[model samples]
Target: MSVPLILTLLAGAATFIGAFLGVLGQKPSNRVLAFSLGFAAGIMLLISLMEMLPAALDTEGMSPVLGYGMFIIGLLGYFGLDRLLPHAHPQDLVQKRQQPLPGSIKRTAILLTLGISLHNFPEGIATFVTASSNLELGFGIALAVALHNIPEGLAVAGPVYAATGSKRTAIFLGRYLRHGGNFWRRAGVADFGQPGFANRYGGYHGSSRRYYGGALRR
Candidate 1:
Protein backbone atom coordinates (compact mmCIF):
# COMPACT_ATOMS: atom_id res chain seq x y z
CA MET A 1 0.00 0.00 0.00
CA SER A 2 0.98 3.64 -0.47
CA VAL A 3 2.70 5.50 2.34
CA PRO A 4 -0.22 7.81 3.02
CA LEU A 5 -2.66 4.95 3.22
CA ILE A 6 -0.36 3.00 5.47
CA LEU A 7 0.11 5.94 7.78
CA THR A 8 -3.60 6.64 7.91
CA LEU A 9 -4.38 3.06 8.80
CA LEU A 10 -1.67 2.96 11.45
CA ALA A 11 -2.87 6.20 12.99
CA GLY A 12 -6.45 4.99 13.03
CA ALA A 13 -5.47 1.71 14.62
CA ALA A 14 -3.42 3.44 17.29
CA THR A 15 -6.32 5.72 18.11
CA PHE A 16 -8.60 2.71 18.38
CA ILE A 17 -6.25 0.96 20.75
CA GLY A 18 -5.98 4.01 22.95
CA ALA A 19 -9.73 4.37 23.03
CA PHE A 20 -10.15 0.71 23.89
CA LEU A 21 -7.74 0.91 26.76
CA GLY A 22 -9.40 4.06 28.06
CA VAL A 23 -12.86 2.52 27.93
CA LEU A 24 -12.26 -1.07 29.01
CA GLY A 25 -9.33 -0.90 31.37
CA GLN A 26 -11.48 -1.18 34.51
CA LYS A 27 -11.30 2.10 36.35
CA PRO A 28 -8.15 3.61 34.95
CA SER A 29 -6.16 5.44 37.58
CA ASN A 30 -6.08 9.21 37.48
CA ARG A 31 -2.30 9.14 37.31
CA VAL A 32 -2.38 6.93 34.23
CA LEU A 33 -4.71 9.33 32.52
CA ALA A 34 -2.67 12.34 33.52
CA PHE A 35 0.61 10.86 32.36
CA SER A 36 -0.87 9.67 29.08
CA LEU A 37 -2.21 13.14 28.41
CA GLY A 38 1.06 14.73 29.41
CA PHE A 39 3.09 12.44 27.19
CA ALA A 40 0.77 13.17 24.28
CA ALA A 41 1.17 16.88 24.83
CA GLY A 42 4.94 16.55 24.86
CA ILE A 43 4.93 14.56 21.64
CA MET A 44 2.70 17.03 19.84
CA LEU A 45 4.64 20.03 21.08
CA LEU A 46 7.94 18.56 19.99
CA ILE A 47 6.68 17.46 16.57
CA SER A 48 4.91 20.74 15.85
CA LEU A 49 7.95 22.82 16.72
CA MET A 50 10.76 20.53 15.62
CA GLU A 51 9.20 18.90 12.55
CA MET A 52 5.94 20.25 11.12
CA LEU A 53 6.76 23.98 11.23
CA PRO A 54 10.27 23.44 9.91
CA ALA A 55 8.96 21.20 7.15
CA ALA A 56 6.38 23.78 6.22
CA LEU A 57 9.22 26.30 5.99
CA ASP A 58 11.03 23.96 3.64
CA THR A 59 8.23 23.81 1.09
CA GLU A 60 9.80 24.96 -2.17
CA GLY A 61 8.93 28.54 -3.21
CA MET A 62 6.86 28.88 -0.06
CA SER A 63 7.75 32.27 1.36
CA PRO A 64 8.81 32.42 4.99
CA VAL A 65 6.28 35.21 5.48
CA LEU A 66 3.46 33.08 4.07
CA GLY A 67 4.58 30.06 6.09
CA TYR A 68 4.65 32.06 9.28
CA GLY A 69 1.25 33.50 8.45
CA MET A 70 -0.19 30.05 7.91
CA PHE A 71 1.40 28.86 11.15
CA ILE A 72 -0.19 31.76 13.02
CA ILE A 73 -3.50 31.03 11.36
CA GLY A 74 -3.27 27.39 12.40
CA LEU A 75 -2.56 28.35 15.98
CA LEU A 76 -5.46 30.78 16.08
CA GLY A 77 -7.77 28.29 14.46
CA TYR A 78 -6.91 25.64 17.05
CA PHE A 79 -7.36 28.12 19.87
CA GLY A 80 -10.70 29.20 18.56
CA LEU A 81 -11.89 25.66 18.32
CA ASP A 82 -10.67 24.83 21.81
CA ARG A 83 -12.27 27.93 23.30
CA LEU A 84 -15.50 27.73 21.32
CA LEU A 85 -16.01 24.06 22.04
CA PRO A 86 -16.21 21.75 25.06
CA HIS A 87 -13.02 19.99 24.24
CA ALA A 88 -11.72 17.22 26.51
CA HIS A 89 -8.31 16.45 27.93
CA PRO A 90 -7.34 14.00 30.66
CA GLN A 91 -6.87 16.65 33.30
CA ASP A 92 -9.97 18.69 32.48
CA LEU A 93 -12.31 16.81 34.83
CA VAL A 94 -12.05 16.08 38.51
CA GLN A 95 -14.00 14.01 40.99
CA LYS A 96 -16.21 16.72 42.36
CA ARG A 97 -18.65 14.14 43.65
CA GLN A 98 -19.06 10.43 43.69
CA GLN A 99 -21.71 11.05 41.11
CA PRO A 100 -22.79 14.14 39.23
CA LEU A 101 -26.47 14.50 38.34
CA PRO A 102 -27.25 11.88 35.74
CA GLY A 103 -28.39 14.15 32.94
CA SER A 104 -25.73 16.76 33.46
CA ILE A 105 -23.07 14.09 33.60
CA LYS A 106 -24.26 12.48 30.38
CA ARG A 107 -24.30 15.80 28.58
CA THR A 108 -20.82 16.65 29.79
CA ALA A 109 -19.45 13.29 28.74
CA ILE A 110 -20.92 13.63 25.25
CA LEU A 111 -19.56 17.12 24.93
CA LEU A 112 -16.13 16.02 26.03
CA THR A 113 -15.99 13.27 23.45
CA LEU A 114 -17.15 15.62 20.69
CA GLY A 115 -14.47 18.10 21.62
CA ILE A 116 -11.81 15.41 21.45
CA SER A 117 -12.94 14.24 18.03
CA LEU A 118 -12.94 17.75 16.56
CA HIS A 119 -9.44 18.18 17.89
CA ASN A 120 -8.40 14.86 16.39
CA PHE A 121 -9.50 15.66 12.85
CA PRO A 122 -6.91 18.35 12.20
CA GLU A 123 -4.32 15.98 13.66
CA GLY A 124 -5.37 13.30 11.24
CA ILE A 125 -5.06 15.71 8.37
CA ALA A 126 -1.67 16.86 9.55
CA THR A 127 -0.46 13.28 9.69
CA PHE A 128 -1.85 12.57 6.24
CA VAL A 129 -0.34 15.64 4.65
CA THR A 130 3.08 15.31 6.28
CA ALA A 131 3.31 11.63 5.45
CA SER A 132 2.31 12.32 1.89
CA SER A 133 5.27 14.66 1.51
CA ASN A 134 7.95 12.96 3.60
CA LEU A 135 7.91 9.52 5.20
CA GLU A 136 9.99 10.40 8.27
CA LEU A 137 8.07 13.56 8.94
CA GLY A 138 4.82 11.67 8.57
CA PHE A 139 6.04 9.09 11.08
CA GLY A 140 6.83 11.78 13.59
CA ILE A 141 3.44 13.38 13.13
CA ALA A 142 1.70 10.05 13.52
CA LEU A 143 3.57 9.28 16.73
CA ALA A 144 2.71 12.66 18.17
CA VAL A 145 -0.89 12.46 17.11
CA ALA A 146 -1.20 8.99 18.58
CA LEU A 147 0.25 10.15 21.87
CA HIS A 148 -2.10 13.11 22.03
CA ASN A 149 -5.15 11.04 21.18
CA ILE A 150 -4.66 8.65 24.13
CA PRO A 151 -5.60 11.22 26.74
CA GLU A 152 -8.48 12.34 24.59
CA GLY A 153 -9.81 8.81 24.73
CA LEU A 154 -9.50 8.85 28.49
CA ALA A 155 -11.22 12.23 28.67
CA VAL A 156 -14.20 10.87 26.81
CA ALA A 157 -14.41 7.65 28.77
CA GLY A 158 -14.01 9.10 32.25
CA PRO A 159 -17.09 11.30 32.30
CA VAL A 160 -19.28 8.89 30.42
CA TYR A 161 -18.38 6.21 32.92
CA ALA A 162 -19.00 8.63 35.75
CA ALA A 163 -22.37 9.72 34.46
CA THR A 164 -23.98 6.51 33.39
CA GLY A 165 -21.78 4.30 35.54
CA SER A 166 -21.80 2.16 32.45
CA LYS A 167 -18.75 0.86 30.61
CA ARG A 168 -20.73 0.76 27.39
CA THR A 169 -21.69 4.41 27.63
CA ALA A 170 -18.11 5.35 28.27
CA ILE A 171 -16.91 3.30 25.31
CA PHE A 172 -19.59 4.77 23.08
CA LEU A 173 -18.60 8.25 24.12
CA GLY A 174 -14.99 7.47 23.33
CA ARG A 175 -16.02 6.16 19.91
CA TYR A 176 -17.85 9.35 18.97
CA LEU A 177 -15.53 11.75 20.79
CA ARG A 178 -14.83 13.67 17.56
CA HIS A 179 -18.38 14.54 16.56
CA GLY A 180 -18.67 18.34 16.00
CA GLY A 181 -22.14 19.18 17.27
CA ASN A 182 -21.31 17.66 20.64
CA PHE A 183 -18.32 19.96 20.99
CA TRP A 184 -20.55 22.98 20.29
CA ARG A 185 -22.91 21.94 23.05
CA ARG A 186 -20.05 21.53 25.48
CA ALA A 187 -18.80 24.95 24.40
CA GLY A 188 -21.97 26.36 25.88
CA VAL A 189 -20.99 24.86 29.21
CA ALA A 190 -17.58 26.50 28.91
CA ASP A 191 -19.18 29.89 28.19
CA PHE A 192 -21.03 29.56 31.43
CA GLY A 193 -17.67 29.98 33.13
CA GLN A 194 -17.42 33.64 32.12
CA PRO A 195 -18.44 36.59 34.28
CA GLY A 196 -21.70 36.73 36.19
CA PHE A 197 -23.33 34.32 38.66
CA ALA A 198 -23.32 31.68 35.96
CA ASN A 199 -19.70 30.99 36.62
CA ARG A 200 -20.55 29.99 40.15
CA TYR A 201 -23.34 27.75 38.96
CA GLY A 202 -21.08 26.34 36.29
CA GLY A 203 -19.04 23.23 37.07
CA TYR A 204 -15.66 24.69 37.73
CA HIS A 205 -13.26 22.28 39.30
CA GLY A 206 -10.06 23.37 40.98
CA SER A 207 -6.79 24.22 39.22
CA SER A 208 -5.69 20.66 38.57
CA ARG A 209 -8.11 20.34 35.72
CA ARG A 210 -6.98 23.69 34.42
CA TYR A 211 -3.32 22.68 34.47
CA TYR A 212 -3.92 19.46 32.58
CA GLY A 213 -6.34 21.10 30.17
CA GLY A 214 -3.85 23.90 29.55
CA ALA A 215 -1.15 21.36 28.82
CA LEU A 216 -3.34 19.64 26.25
CA ARG A 217 -4.41 22.99 24.86
CA ARG A 218 -0.77 23.69 24.12
Candidate 2:
Protein backbone atom coordinates (compact mmCIF):
# COMPACT_ATOMS: atom_id res chain seq x y z
CA MET A 1 0.00 0.00 0.00
CA SER A 2 1.02 3.62 -0.50
CA VAL A 3 2.67 5.58 2.29
CA PRO A 4 -0.01 8.24 2.02
CA LEU A 5 -2.78 5.71 2.54
CA ILE A 6 -0.96 4.22 5.49
CA LEU A 7 -0.54 7.60 7.15
CA THR A 8 -4.18 8.54 6.62
CA LEU A 9 -5.38 5.26 8.13
CA LEU A 10 -3.08 5.60 11.12
CA ALA A 11 -4.27 9.13 11.71
CA GLY A 12 -7.92 8.15 11.50
CA ALA A 13 -7.35 5.17 13.80
CA ALA A 14 -6.24 7.49 16.62
CA THR A 15 -9.94 8.00 17.28
CA PHE A 16 -10.03 4.49 18.72
CA ILE A 17 -7.62 5.51 21.44
CA GLY A 18 -9.98 8.25 22.51
CA ALA A 19 -12.93 5.89 22.32
CA PHE A 20 -11.22 3.51 24.72
CA LEU A 21 -10.56 6.37 27.09
CA GLY A 22 -14.22 7.34 26.99
CA VAL A 23 -15.53 3.84 27.63
CA LEU A 24 -13.06 3.37 30.49
CA GLY A 25 -14.33 6.55 32.14
CA GLN A 26 -10.93 8.21 32.02
CA LYS A 27 -10.54 11.81 31.00
CA PRO A 28 -7.30 13.53 30.29
CA SER A 29 -6.43 16.49 32.43
CA ASN A 30 -7.56 19.75 30.87
CA ARG A 31 -4.04 21.12 30.88
CA VAL A 32 -2.68 18.15 28.96
CA LEU A 33 -5.51 18.23 26.43
CA ALA A 34 -4.98 21.92 25.92
CA PHE A 35 -1.26 21.55 25.40
CA SER A 36 -1.68 18.71 22.93
CA LEU A 37 -4.28 20.54 20.93
CA GLY A 38 -2.19 23.70 20.91
CA PHE A 39 0.80 21.80 19.65
CA ALA A 40 -1.23 20.30 16.84
CA ALA A 41 -2.56 23.69 15.87
CA GLY A 42 0.94 25.10 15.77
CA ILE A 43 2.12 22.37 13.49
CA MET A 44 -0.73 22.90 11.07
CA LEU A 45 -0.27 26.67 11.09
CA LEU A 46 3.44 26.46 10.39
CA ILE A 47 3.04 23.91 7.65
CA SER A 48 0.26 25.75 5.93
CA LEU A 49 1.85 29.17 6.09
CA MET A 50 5.53 28.37 5.70
CA GLU A 51 5.43 25.30 3.53
CA MET A 52 2.13 24.75 1.71
CA LEU A 53 1.39 28.37 0.89
CA PRO A 54 4.90 29.11 -0.35
CA ALA A 55 4.99 25.95 -2.34
CA ALA A 56 1.61 26.74 -3.88
CA LEU A 57 2.65 30.18 -5.04
CA ASP A 58 5.93 28.90 -6.45
CA THR A 59 4.18 26.52 -8.79
CA GLU A 60 4.64 27.60 -12.41
CA GLY A 61 1.76 29.67 -13.79
CA MET A 62 0.38 30.24 -10.25
CA SER A 63 -0.20 33.95 -9.74
CA PRO A 64 -0.10 35.60 -6.32
CA VAL A 65 -3.74 36.60 -6.56
CA LEU A 66 -4.90 33.06 -7.18
CA GLY A 67 -2.81 31.50 -4.44
CA TYR A 68 -3.69 34.06 -1.77
CA GLY A 69 -7.26 34.15 -2.96
CA MET A 70 -7.62 30.41 -2.45
CA PHE A 71 -6.05 30.65 1.00
CA ILE A 72 -8.55 33.32 2.02
CA ILE A 73 -11.38 31.22 0.67
CA GLY A 74 -10.19 28.29 2.73
CA LEU A 75 -10.17 30.34 5.90
CA LEU A 76 -13.65 31.67 5.24
CA GLY A 77 -14.98 28.23 4.39
CA TYR A 78 -13.63 26.73 7.60
CA PHE A 79 -15.33 29.38 9.70
CA GLY A 80 -18.57 29.04 7.77
CA LEU A 81 -18.75 25.29 8.31
CA ASP A 82 -17.73 25.62 11.92
CA ARG A 83 -20.70 27.87 12.57
CA LEU A 84 -23.13 25.53 10.84
CA LEU A 85 -22.11 22.40 12.71
CA PRO A 86 -23.84 21.47 15.98
CA HIS A 87 -20.96 21.52 18.42
CA ALA A 88 -21.31 20.80 22.12
CA HIS A 89 -18.47 20.37 24.51
CA PRO A 90 -18.16 17.08 26.38
CA GLN A 91 -18.68 18.92 29.64
CA ASP A 92 -21.84 20.49 28.28
CA LEU A 93 -23.15 17.10 27.29
CA VAL A 94 -22.34 15.22 30.52
CA GLN A 95 -22.22 17.87 33.25
CA LYS A 96 -25.95 17.96 33.88
CA ARG A 97 -27.81 15.96 36.50
CA GLN A 98 -26.34 12.65 37.49
CA GLN A 99 -29.19 10.94 35.70
CA PRO A 100 -29.97 12.89 32.60
CA LEU A 101 -32.72 11.77 30.24
CA PRO A 102 -31.57 8.82 28.11
CA GLY A 103 -33.33 9.97 24.97
CA SER A 104 -31.80 13.42 25.08
CA ILE A 105 -28.35 12.04 25.74
CA LYS A 106 -28.61 9.57 22.87
CA ARG A 107 -29.78 12.28 20.53
CA THR A 108 -26.82 14.45 21.46
CA ALA A 109 -24.40 11.59 20.89
CA ILE A 110 -25.86 10.87 17.47
CA LEU A 111 -25.63 14.51 16.43
CA LEU A 112 -22.07 14.74 17.63
CA THR A 113 -21.13 11.64 15.70
CA LEU A 114 -22.75 12.90 12.52
CA GLY A 115 -21.13 16.31 12.75
CA ILE A 116 -17.72 14.82 13.41
CA SER A 117 -18.08 12.25 10.64
CA LEU A 118 -19.01 14.89 8.14
CA HIS A 119 -16.04 16.98 9.19
CA ASN A 120 -13.58 14.14 8.83
CA PHE A 121 -14.12 13.83 5.10
CA PRO A 122 -12.28 17.06 4.36
CA GLU A 123 -9.52 16.23 6.82
CA GLY A 124 -8.97 12.91 5.08
CA ILE A 125 -8.61 14.64 1.75
CA ALA A 126 -6.11 17.17 3.06
CA THR A 127 -4.08 14.51 4.81
CA PHE A 128 -3.99 12.36 1.69
CA VAL A 129 -2.95 15.21 -0.58
CA THR A 130 -0.24 16.52 1.73
CA ALA A 131 1.29 13.10 2.16
CA SER A 132 1.14 12.16 -1.51
CA SER A 133 2.80 15.41 -2.55
CA ASN A 134 5.51 15.52 0.07
CA LEU A 135 6.08 12.50 2.29
CA GLU A 136 7.89 14.45 5.03
CA LEU A 137 5.18 17.09 5.37
CA GLY A 138 2.56 14.36 5.20
CA PHE A 139 3.83 12.76 8.39
CA GLY A 140 3.60 16.04 10.27
CA ILE A 141 0.09 16.70 8.97
CA ALA A 142 -0.98 13.19 9.94
CA LEU A 143 0.38 13.58 13.45
CA ALA A 144 -1.45 16.87 13.85
CA VAL A 145 -4.67 15.35 12.60
CA ALA A 146 -4.32 12.29 14.84
CA LEU A 147 -3.71 14.47 17.86
CA HIS A 148 -6.99 16.35 17.41
CA ASN A 149 -9.01 13.26 16.46
CA ILE A 150 -8.37 11.51 19.76
CA PRO A 151 -10.35 14.11 21.66
CA GLU A 152 -13.08 13.94 19.04
CA GLY A 153 -13.50 10.23 19.63
CA LEU A 154 -13.74 10.80 23.36
CA ALA A 155 -16.37 13.42 22.78
CA VAL A 156 -18.49 11.03 20.77
CA ALA A 157 -18.01 7.92 22.89
CA GLY A 158 -18.44 9.52 26.30
CA PRO A 159 -21.98 10.67 25.64
CA VAL A 160 -22.95 7.43 23.98
CA TYR A 161 -21.71 5.36 26.88
CA ALA A 162 -23.53 7.66 29.28
CA ALA A 163 -26.79 7.34 27.43
CA THR A 164 -26.74 3.66 26.46
CA GLY A 165 -24.73 2.24 29.36
CA SER A 166 -23.10 -0.10 26.87
CA LYS A 167 -19.38 0.07 26.31
CA ARG A 168 -19.48 -1.96 23.09
CA THR A 169 -21.98 0.26 21.37
CA ALA A 170 -20.23 3.40 22.49
CA ILE A 171 -16.84 2.26 21.25
CA PHE A 172 -18.15 0.92 17.95
CA LEU A 173 -20.12 3.99 17.05
CA GLY A 174 -17.54 6.44 18.33
CA ARG A 175 -14.54 4.85 16.66
CA TYR A 176 -16.08 3.62 13.42
CA LEU A 177 -18.72 6.21 12.76
CA ARG A 178 -16.32 9.10 13.23
CA HIS A 179 -13.41 7.39 11.51
CA GLY A 180 -15.55 5.84 8.78
CA GLY A 181 -15.96 9.08 6.85
CA ASN A 182 -12.24 9.69 6.91
CA PHE A 183 -11.42 6.20 5.65
CA TRP A 184 -13.74 6.42 2.66
CA ARG A 185 -12.55 9.87 1.67
CA ARG A 186 -8.96 8.74 1.79
CA ALA A 187 -9.82 5.74 -0.33
CA GLY A 188 -11.48 7.98 -2.88
CA VAL A 189 -8.43 10.24 -3.03
CA ALA A 190 -6.23 7.19 -3.37
CA ASP A 191 -8.14 6.24 -6.48
CA PHE A 192 -7.57 9.72 -7.82
CA GLY A 193 -3.83 9.26 -7.27
CA GLN A 194 -3.71 6.02 -9.19
CA PRO A 195 -1.60 5.90 -12.40
CA GLY A 196 -4.59 6.59 -14.58
CA PHE A 197 -5.69 9.98 -13.24
CA ALA A 198 -2.99 11.78 -11.28
CA ASN A 199 -0.23 10.84 -13.72
CA ARG A 200 -2.18 11.64 -16.85
CA TYR A 201 -3.43 14.92 -15.48
CA GLY A 202 0.07 15.81 -14.24
CA GLY A 203 -1.31 18.52 -12.02
CA TYR A 204 -1.30 16.50 -8.81
CA HIS A 205 1.32 18.53 -6.94
CA GLY A 206 -0.17 21.88 -7.90
CA SER A 207 -3.65 20.75 -7.03
CA SER A 208 -2.43 19.25 -3.79
CA ARG A 209 -0.91 22.55 -2.71
CA ARG A 210 -4.06 24.50 -3.59
CA TYR A 211 -6.31 22.08 -1.76
CA TYR A 212 -3.99 21.98 1.23
CA GLY A 213 -4.10 25.75 1.49
CA GLY A 214 -7.89 25.84 1.49
CA ALA A 215 -8.95 22.54 3.04
CA LEU A 216 -6.61 22.81 5.99
CA ARG A 217 -7.14 26.50 6.50
CA ARG A 218 -6.60 26.03 10.19
Candidate closest to the true structure, highest TM-score? 2
Best lDDT among the predictions, by candidate number: 2
Candidate 2: segments with Cα more than 4 A from true spot: 90-100, 190-192, 200-204
Misplaced by over 4 Å in model 1 are: 13-15, 25-31, 92-100, 178-218
How good is model 2 by TM-score? 0.89
Q: Candidate 2: lDDT of 56?
A: 76
Q: Residues 1-218, candidate 1: write the lDDT tens digits.
A: 56754564455445445556655654457787667667767777776666666665665555667666666666766777779878654556433246455687778777666566666555555555456556786786667666665656666676666666677766666556533423332353234323353235332222211222223235
lDDT of each: 0.56, 0.76
* Ten residues in sequence with the least summed lDDT for candidate 1: 203-212
User: Which ten residues in a row are the worst by lDDT in model 2?
Assistant: 88-97
Using alpha carbons, what is the TM-score of model 1?
0.70
Question: In model 1, what is the error at residue 187, expressed in angstroms?
Answer: 24
